[model samples]
Target: MRQILLFAALAAVLALLLVSCGGTKDKPVPTEEDAPGKAAYHKISAEEAYEMMISQEIVVVDVRTREEYDGGHIENAVLVPNESIGSEMPETLPDKEATLLIYCRSGRRSKDAAQKLLALGYQSVYDFGGVIDWPYELVKEG
Candidate 1:
């Protein structure tokens, strides 16, 4: 009788655990790829990104507002506001596997934009904060 009670209790506990975990028999365990981390979305210095810009082929994305970008922006940086990263990627940038160097007016917008870009299937996205910290040349629109 004691052995029967022990078996029943163990079975009950096992059933509870399975039900608590969504009750799915074939569900795989979640991994970091299921949710990206900060390191995956690298936050490098402006100088680092600048060196890449000069030395290698990289796409620089500015996540600031149009007015902010129009004020002054790093040369060769394209405007793709954080709010504009919709379900579809910008037509100007269609390569999901491209190495993207992203920035904004400050660090906040760039971080948000980088995550969104990653979620949208951008494989390599780097958030280098704002151009305000960039100790380099800036281009003003006419």
Candidate 2:
């Protein structure tokens, strides 16, 4: 009886350990002041982006092809294709401390661009998904 009780206790302890070590929880959204080398971008909704656009002076970046951009894009959004981003900072975007709002056609490239910008030390980067999700008016190229 004593041996059986010891084995049961050991099994219970092992199960608890396994449960505790199973997986990690989702990380919280990073802020502008998050430590260097950490994720420095924030994922915001289109509504939130619109609110910010109305309330602040932000640099809206369209991380899509020029062809797609010419079709239609957010007003005042600059074209900086994800493929064009290199080791050096983009000339159009000179201020690393400025608030950057990024978007792509379907949210994939925007995320990639936002991460790259953050890695490049651009503080206050916000990924507001894609332009398809943007309900606001778009400006077409002349």
Candidate 3:
């Protein structure tokens, strides 16, 4: 009976320690919590994304290969190849809280990248479709 009591006491102490370390409700929320593990994805128009780009400090990301990006892409889009987003985020985008605008040659890569970005803890991720659907002028990297 004494041993059981001691084990119960230890368990209670461990539970308290775990609760304390879990995190406080009053603490500042993590950026990743807002958009975690592909649970968040916003589909917006190219025009809307462009407008936001002009108005906000957003990161426009191209989730395609270097060759695909060199062919033609929206001006000022940082390359974060889709295959490179696991364990750690792409070097091009370190801020998990940044409003990320992602795209690719077609909608598929953009969709995949958007989900991966969310999984990597990006707070505000927007998938504005692909360059193929973009009506805006695209510039080729020479």
Q: Give the TM-scores of the predictions, in the order they appear.
A: 0.72, 0.75, 0.71
**What ranking of all candidate models by lDDT puts the best one first?**
2, 3, 1
lDDT of each: 0.87, 0.91, 0.87
Local lDDT at 17 for model 3? 86
Residue 26 of model 3, lDDT score:
58
Which 10-residue window of candidate 3 scores lowest in summed lDDT?
Answer: 30-39
lDDT of 3 by residue, 1-142 (tens): 9999999999999989878787355566667545445347888988899899899999999998999999998899999999888878788898998899999887888989999888778878999988988888888987
Give lDDT for model 1.
0.87
Please say which candidate is ahead in TM-score: 1 or 2.
Answer: 2
Best by lDDT: 2
lDDT of 1 at 142: 88
Per-residue CA lDDT of model 2 for 46-90, tens digit only, reads: 999999999999999999999999999999999999999978899
Q: Number of clashing residue pairs in every model?
A: 0, 0, 0
